[model samples]
Target chain A: MKLIVSVKRVIDYNIKVRVKADNTGVDLANVKMALNPFCEIAVEEAIRLKEAGVASEVVVVSIGPTAVQEQLRTALALGADRAIHVETDELPEPLNVAKLLAKVIEAEQPGLVILGKQSIDSDNNQVGQMLAALAGRPQGTFASEVKVEGGKVLVTREVDGGLRTLSLDLPAIVTTDLRLNEPRYAKLPDIMKAKRKPLDVKTPADLGVELKQHITQLKVETPAQREAGIKVDSVDALIDKLKNEAKVI
Target chain B: MNILLDSIEKVVGSQNVLRGEDVRSRTADWMTKEPCLAGAIVRPANTEQLSEVMALCYEANQAVVTHGGLTGLVRGGMASSDELVISLERMTQIESIDCVSGTMTVQAGAPLQSVQEAADQAEMQFNLDLGARGSCTIGGNIATNAGGIRVIRYGMMRDLVLGVEAVLADGTVVNSMNTMLKNNAGYDLKQLFIGSEGTLGIVTRAVLKLHPQLTATNTALVACEDFNSLTGLLQHARKSLGGELCAFEVMWSSYYSLLTTESNRHTPPISSDAPYYVLIESLGAEQKESHERFEKAIESAFEKGLLIDAVLASSDHQREKLWAIREDVEGLAHLLAPRFAFDISLPILEMDKYVRKLQSAVSQRWKNAKVIVFGHLGDGNLHVSVATGDASDETREAVESLVYEPLKLMGGSVSAEHGIGLKKRKYLNLSRTPAEIALMQTLKIALDPRGLLNRNKVLPDILA
Candidate 1:
């Protein structure tokens, strides 16, 4: 069984993001970028399934401009068998991305598809469900644990209060959460070999999809800096201060 | 001694003086996990309090050892049963940071990691970093002139320190707290205590130089087939990376294999079959351009046959993992127990031949000894450890001879970054000439006439 994992390139989580002086957007001219952390978890899960003999191959796909290939190469180094790049100059809306992924899924016909629950950049948690709807397959969203048993994918989802288990048939989609598995560092030999691995780059038009921007961003501003709070001696004093000074009672 | 302890208690407060079991419970040595044997441990709140306590000790002719974070490999912080320990544990305040001037005024007892974090929070960096950053104190780092991975780019602790505030043995405070980048007002008095290993005086506070924090970091673990290629690769990285090269750590296959394969403590990032592996790093202002330059350097090194195999970390996590393998000193110590660890520096060209000769000498005596070698090659320092299943004093002396005797001819120092504390004091002659030794002795006598501070450390005993 072939496992397909979708990845996205985003600003590295370690960077302290800066807002442009003009308030246009984040100042990301030379910021460090890496595979979105959640996407890395998804790729790690797919690779583990292959290592466990449940999946014969792991293929990673990403959609963006040429810069996204760096993330694709990273996934390949992390033991993905191959990669497909749905190249476009601008990032598409979630619906359009799902459409493009649906076309790739049809062409590859993988038994399982994995994706991060949301992209950290956009924080849009709709792509997996939309792709499942487009591909006519069941999806297990916010998966904390995933297991393949007897031609069925068992996914344990982290919900509002507790974990909920869901069993989906073959050809299912699973969106990874925080606790699926910890990713492994790519070995040196694998990184060198990843350079030689096959990476097929195609346009969104080739996938029968068109990129579109649905939401308009008006302006960006940094959040207000929090002021340091004073320490109160006792609960009664804290209550009195909160009620009288803060007027929160 | 009891009267002296009582006087110290009065100066620093009764609660600050620990006696009996409290003094016995604290650890004195990091390697042996030995409990402190000091009769009493005094915690000074600040430089003034410490000076008053020192005066009391001086009046009574009491010998005292200053304890920071007791993480020295040379047993420099060790205290005897009759001695008193002056611990700077309570004087750990970060006084102030001059962001415009790029300097931080910090108390001595602050951990090195905390100072680094503070600098980082202020958009600057403290370049002295090591495996023991979490536990080692800034005072200890300053005392030993600590050199770690980044010494290739930033000089040792001496270079990072702008000024120091120390309490002399006779209770005189030398407040040479100069915060300027270029100060030629008079003799640099701070240099006396910078690398003296707390023998001359106790460092109570320091003004440290800080650098602008580099936003971009590139790391790679490259394999070399031979030592020549490894040195060539270092030169190539230095030239190609264009002074952005921060670290060039080379690990011998024997050391790498022991930690990764033999002990199974670490996951080997690359095959340990190569004769050598180098962890190269570069820091820059911007990400995209720096990464491009880093990649070009590595690619050219490969094309020039300076490296056999290489892997560039795709993310910060991967970069840390690559560094973990190089910084596995605890793993090496655990696996090579009953081992003689040597931190020596020689000319880069002589390191390969010296290690081979030392290995043969060690194995000839122990028959099945293992010699592990690795260190900051860019700084001409190598940490060599030999395990022969015995840690006896006689065996230790023999092994020390095998390591230190050859360095005299090779023009290498017996102690590299780890100062010549009690462990390497006897071998000081191997690294220093008679004139240098006499001058060191004269300085020690002039500064600490009564030898009341950190006695029997960093200096050998006078001939009877």
Candidate 2:
């Protein structure tokens, strides 16, 4: 089966997020950006599937600014086959991204579509589901385990309490979770080869997808601070505080 | 694929076979915003079932990925659509807690918080801790060799783990769960899988070493004029508190100010205006002496002019409040659009200069970038975050080179607490020798011959 993994270029999670002074959006003027953490997992998973012979080809697709081609190259370095960069300077909302990606899905018609559940920068965990909806395909989210059998996908989801199992037919959209797989590092040679791989860039106009704004930002403020409390002198005092003041017990 | 499913169903039963929407929930990890792409997820209740699943996967040449608690900072647990994932979620029983031996034998899927609670119930202590303790698993901790607050006293996960039970690619179970503290066995095979990030083998269970519960605890926040004073204060605390000193976390002024800002959760215990702050803690068997010694150490440091100001925690509430400033990094998330969190280590002698150089380099590269530094200074580990005004690949690469290049020249590790998950893989050679990396690959090839177990993770691509 041909596997197509969709990745995104987002601000690295380790970096602190800052709101713009004008409250227009996040200040991304000089921050470090990389492939979304979940997308990296998607790339890793596709490579593994191809290596195991379960997948014939693993293609990567990204819908973002022209610079997102770098992220596509990263996926290629980690072992994706070819890449499609839906080039646009403006980042469309998840729905628009899903729309553009849906076109690519329709064109390539891979058996499976894998993407990150949410982008850490935006925390909008809706793209994969929206894409699945737009593509009219079954979807799985927060998968801890996945297996293929008889042209269907079996996924183990981690719910709040315990594990829940589900199965879906082929040609489905699956988003990645943290516990699904450990992504492999791109080897130096792969990095060089990725530069030579086929990276086809398409414009939003070419794809016939309109860029739309879905979410508006008002203001972003720092989280509230914790209050300081007095330290007691003895264990008995600590016990007293826990019992009466803090009331954790 | 049908044969693989039949074998898995035989091992785990049809009830545990998850697919579709269930697959999506299981596919994504804690860090990723993506849904799971796995073909299926299998939960084995015990090592035997897991072994059987591995055998089937090996026969089918199916790619298998192992899932723990999914709390890793790096994207290690994300699975693909075609690969089969083996989650240890069903194998979470704490088999035994030996109070006398101060050891706990547990299944790999046990949450770290659960282990800590079990140790507490048994009147012992499991010293490993991190922000994700509530969700991270013991196996994941062992895989990442996670380090946290108590690493100053107890060391990393590698030290806390005595022995582990793992299954190789071909269903070979290597049970080396040693309970004793001093096991000078051949090769120390457990080390290979401890921080391999589940590339070599799937850890099934483990025997972890524990410590006697700390009866007396004392905490204090001390202000230092500079790194020299901070080092002097650390030496004083160690000498005075002796083996009782459990934590000595240093916070640079930038971090301290950020934590104590008007909008933050905690007010500064000291002035929050100091150039450097050290949050010190001592845990011992005697409460009175522990407090007395802790107070005396700070008093002497003050007398010696090494300390600018000191606030002793006379109560547990105060202690936690002081620690909140150092431990609560989530609050500072709003300072920069893209924050580059780096956990790098250098020799104590060179750390100050190295940090200054890092700051200078970051400033030179991005004049507006904010460099906030802090960490377990006692352990030669520094947690740095460079806030780039704009989030871009160029800025990320520039920041990484600025922070990592100094470590190569200073004989420091690229990663001190965090493992080289895909993010830091290229810089692995900064601290490790070429021969060392080669040995890692040799071991990887030996254990996972097909390179299917977390393939392409820690070791660089050998074919390259």
Candidate 3:
């Protein structure tokens, strides 16, 4: 069976993101970008299934500008069999992307479609559910554990209180959570060979789908910095400040 | 009484002074797991504030122990309840990076990791690196004259430091902040404080020299069948690698195997076999040509019977794993408890015989004792550790005597990189002559007449 994974490019976690002076968006000039953490987990899960011999092939897809191919190549380096880049100037809304993915699913008909719970960038948390609705398949979101048997996938999802388990038949959609698996480092030898892997590029027109946007972002800004706190000399002083200065107690 | 505390508070605002439970909350040093024994710790913001604080303490006849990251291998940063700590924790600031001069002026307390990162951003590096870079401070490195993995290419901390700003015991600030490569103007005052271990003065700030960041770094771990092969391989690397040879670290089979196999330790990239393993690294400008030369060097070493097996790290991830095996010795702390670590400098020719004799002597003393040896073979520095399964005071004393007893005859110094703290005070005479000791004492009396700045360290206490 074939496993299709969705990979997205996001800012590297170690870097401190800078907000633009005009508040247009994050200033990404010359900043290091890497595969989204959740997406990496999704790729890792797909690779595990392939390693277990349950999946014959793993194909990773990314939808964005030309630069996003870097993330696709990284996924290939990490053990994905092949890559497909749906070329577009900007990422579409979750619903439009779900429609585009649905078109790809109709053509390829993969047994499992794994995606990140949400891209760290934008963080819509809607693509997996929308894709499941468009494809008419059972869905598992925020999956922490996944087990596969004959014709079914048991997904343990992360919920508010604890984990909840659900069983979905094959040809299902599942989004990965942090605990799905620890991603492996792309080995040097594999990275060198990943450049040779097949990477097919196409536009939304090639997939017989039209991309459209519904929501418009007016501006983006960084969160306000918290004020530094002062240490109190004693418990009495702390309580006094809380009652009079902080005015909360 | 609170009078002295109030005086110190006046010097460096009341909030900067940490006492009572706060002092107890901090660990003594990187090695000691126990709470610190300090009357109070004053964190001055910059050089002026530190000078004022020192003045107040000096007038009160108080003993002040300067504190950095507390990552000293020797007990140099150790303090007792009678001593007050002048911690540079609050003075952490990378004031500026002068690209033209290739220098960085930093307050004494900035962590080495951030300094390295900042230098990297400026397309340069301080080239003073060690395993403790994450936790240690630039001040501590300067105070100890730290010699790390790259000493072969970039010399020790003393060579990297261009100038230093130190506060004397009498609270006088001596700022020799020179940012030039060639400044032969009079006596360089920075040399006195570089490796004085805080006895001469408390280092408050420093102007550190930086080097152009090397674009190409090639690393490999090779197995050596014998000591002669290790020497031959070193010669081969020196010839083939040219001036790009940066690090050549040798780990004896005992330590290499122990750390690689220890629980929570980084697994070795190459199989742990043979009597020794040498980690070779070369950094240069041309990546392709340097890599070719490095590979050729290793291949020639193997062809000439200088090395048995070799594995090159082709990626940063692979290189980091090989380095982790050397840097994360703390992972084996549980198995090697009650260990004695010695950083000794001796002739490279004397190492093989010295190690064999030391191991034999330690085994005869403790039947189950294990000797783990590793260090920078290029710098004539050996870090020898002995674990006797006992951390008792008697065991520590016995191991110290065993390690230092033969050093005098070999014309070796008791310490190579780590300065003599309270731990090695008694062994000072073994390394320094009586006249040299007298001169050191005379200078100590002349500069710090009160004998308060890091007293009873690096030199033997007066024998009444």
Candidate 4:
């Protein structure tokens, strides 16, 4: 069985991003970028499956500009057999990205596909479900744990209230949540070998998918700074201020 | 104390002062959870206000303790019950970043991480970095002359600092903020304040020298068979890496095994069974060339029997993983609770024999003692941690004597990068000659004649 894991490059979680002056989006110039943390969990799940002998090969796929190949290389170094880079000037919206991934799924015919529940940048959480709908496959999203047995993948999802288990047939879609697995660091030797691993590049045109935008970002502004609170001398002063100044007592 | 607080409030606004329970609620330092017992915590927003507060303290002969991030293991920043804590918490501001000159002027209270971030924003690198970077302040780094992982290449905090502005204990402001690379005009007075542990003066601001950001970083964790091979590997790495080498951290087998076997946390990337592991990192301009050279050096080292096995990090994540193993000092403390940790410096050639003697001495004292050793082998600094499942004052004294007593004969320093704070003040003479100690005392008495600044720290009381 073959497994396909999807990854995305995003700003490092540790960094404090600044808003651009024009407010179109975050100013990413001269910022550190890493593999999307949730996507790392997804890639780790796929590698674990391969290591468990439930899967033979793991192919990591990324849909973005040339710079996103860095994330693909990271995935490869973390144990992916190869990488498929869907080259595009700008990444399309979730529905269209699902259409393009559906094309790759049809072409590759993998037994299972794993993706992050949501990228930290967008937080859309739509691509995996849309891809499953386009490919006519069952999806076990937000999977905290995943196990493959008897041509089926058992996914334990982290629901709002508690755990929810579901068994999906082969050729299913799974979106990994944070508790899925901890990703391993790419070893130095593996990183050197990842450079030699095959990375096939394709375009949306080659997949016969036309890009369509369903949403337009109007402006991106940082949240308003919190007002500093004043310290009251005593309980009496606090009550007096709340009653007289705040007028909410 | 109340009258002194009132005078301090006149210099710095009353709102800036934290008193009574507020001062007592805060922890003394990062190493301990004990509630601080200072009379008050005075936070001045700027250097001028700090000088004013210092002037008041001098007039009253009131003892003052300067506080940075307080992450130091030594009790340098610890204040007594009556002493007032003059904290730089409010002075945290990066005043300017000179891109052309490659220098930054920052207030002392700014965290090292914030300074590093600002340097990153300017596309420059601040070479002084350590595990406490996020918590440690620029003032603390300057005061202690912090020697971190990159000290092998960038030298200590002393080398990274261009100029410093400090307030003398008597409230005199000394402004020698020179940013030039070479200014041999007169005495470099900044050296007097740095590494002085706030006994001479309180650092308020500094002009820090920055380096051009190195784009390429190559890191590896390699295994060596024995101490000789480890030293040989260091020589080989330095030769092959040349000026690119920034860090050469070595971990003994015990330290490596302890850090890795946590299993649920900090998974080891390679086998921890190796006798020694060296985390080598190099920074350069050309990524491909540096990576190739790093790999070639490792290959040659293996061929020369300097390394038994090695793993190189191909990406930033991998590099961070290799560093995490070395930087997990807190985990080391947890694995050996109530441990007596020593940071000592000796010649590289004497390290193996010193460890053997120390090991034998420790085992003779306690048959079941567990000792873990690791440090920046490049700078000849080793951090030795000993644990014997006993936490008593007498046991601690015995352990400290055992560690520092042997170093005197070995011509090694009892305190390496960590200064002679309250912790190692008793053993100052072990590492210093009588003449050297006298000169240090003369300088201390001349600068802080009242002995009110950081009292009972750095210099022993007997010297006074």
At residue B191, what lDDT does model 1 achieve? Answer: 96
The order by descending DockQ is 1, 4, 3, 2
Q: Pairing residues by index, what is the TM-score of model 4?
A: 0.85
Instruction: Provide TM-scores for the models.
Output: 0.89, 0.64, 0.76, 0.85
Write candidate 2's Cα lDDT for A192-245 as tens digits: 577799999898888887787867667776668689778789999999899998
lDDT of 2 at A151: 92
TM-score of chain B of 1: 0.99
| Candidate 4 RMSD to the correct structure | 4.1
* Worst 10-residue lDDT window, candidate 4 chain A: A183-192
| Candidate 2 per-residue lDDT over residues B231-333, each given as its tens digit | 8888888887788888889999988887787556776656767899888888877654665676667667777888887765533444667777777766766
Q: Write the per-residue lDDT of candidate 4 for residues B16-54, one digit (tens) a residue.
A: 889888988899966667788888899999999999989
The per-model DockQ list reads 0.40, 0.01, 0.07, 0.21
**Model 4: per-residue Cα lDDT over A52-169, one tens digit each:** 8999999999999998997898899889999999998886788888999999999999999999998888889999999999999999999999989898999999878899999999
Candidate 3's TM-score: 0.76
Clashing pairs in 3: none
Alpha-carbon runs more than 4 Å astray in model 2: A1-249, B1-3, B26-29
Quality class of the docking in candidate 4, CAPRI style: incorrect
C-alpha displacement of B45 in model 1, angstroms? 1.4
Q: lDDT for model 1, on a 0 to 1 scale? A: 0.91
True contacts kept of each: 0.39, 0.00, 0.00, 0.18
For model 3, residues B1-464, the per-residue Cα lDDT tens digits are 25777987887899998899999999877776778888999888888988887888888888988889898977887778888888999878999999888999999899998899899888798899998888888898998898899998899999999989999998999998999999998998899899889999999899999988776777888889999888888888888899889999999998888887655465665567789999999998775577668767777787788887777664454577788887766865665876878999898888999999999999998999999999999899999999998889998999999999899999998999988998888899999999999998888888788988887788887553
